[model samples]
Target: MGRPRVRFTGRTEADAEAVLAAAAAHDACLSGAPADWEIPAGCAA
Candidate 1:
């Protein structure tokens, strides 16, 4: 098993942020141990 991957695509910054936040929130919720949800380096929102 491996970490889940989410692909986010949006035209506007607001929409991109929304998707990014949603992905992070979902990832955090699914994690069994304390995890860092910081946006990955080089990621553009």
Candidate 2:
């Protein structure tokens, strides 16, 4: 069997962050992601 999946969509950055936080709470491994990615122009929060 394959692992179950969950998806979230948000129109704002804060909404996106909330969804990400919820997912991470359920899976500790998700909280260890790298933080070296760059945000493109006008995409900065």
Candidate 3:
């Protein structure tokens, strides 16, 4: 299986950041991973 993908659409940068932050927090809580998540170089705007 391949990694899952999430698509966020918005008219501003804040919207995208919010989605990424939320996803990161969700992942950390569910997987017991670190909360500090960095967006990949290629994935960041």
Candidate 4:
């Protein structure tokens, strides 16, 4: 079976970008990424 998928629908582009940024930060923290890691351009929205 395929892995379950999760989708986020924000009311606006800005909202969606905020959600994506938060998710990226959370992921980085969990993975013990370097504090100076830069957010990808796409993820910057």
The whole-model lDDT of each prediction reads: 0.54, 0.43, 0.50, 0.49
Ranking by lDDT: 1, 3, 4, 2
- In the predicted model 1, the residue pairs found to clash are none
Clashing pairs in 4: none
Q: Which stretches of candidate 3 lie over 4 Å from their true place?
A: 1-14, 31-45
How close is every model to the real structure, measured as TM-score? 0.37, 0.36, 0.36, 0.36
* Candidate 4 RMSD computed on C-alpha atoms after optimal superposition onto the true structure: 8.5
The deviation in Å at residue 25 for candidate 4 is 0.2
Number of the top-ranking candidate, with lDDT as the measure: 1
Would you list the clashing residue pairs of candidate 3?
Answer: none
Candidate 4 per-residue C-alpha lDDT over 1-45 given as tens digits, one digit per residue, 9 for 90 to 100? 432232344346756665577556656554434344455444443
lDDT (C-alpha) at residue 6 in model 1: 58
* TM-score between model 1 and native: 0.37
User: How far off is residue 10 in model 4, in Å?
Assistant: 8.8
Residue 3 in model 4: shift from native, Å? 19
Model 3 C-alpha lDDT versus the unseen true structure: 0.50
Tens-digit lDDT string for candidate 3 (1-45): 433444544436646656667577546554433334544333445
lDDT of 4: 0.49
Q: Which is superior by TM-score, 1 or 3?
A: 1
Q: Over all chains combined, what TM-score does candidate 4 have? A: 0.36
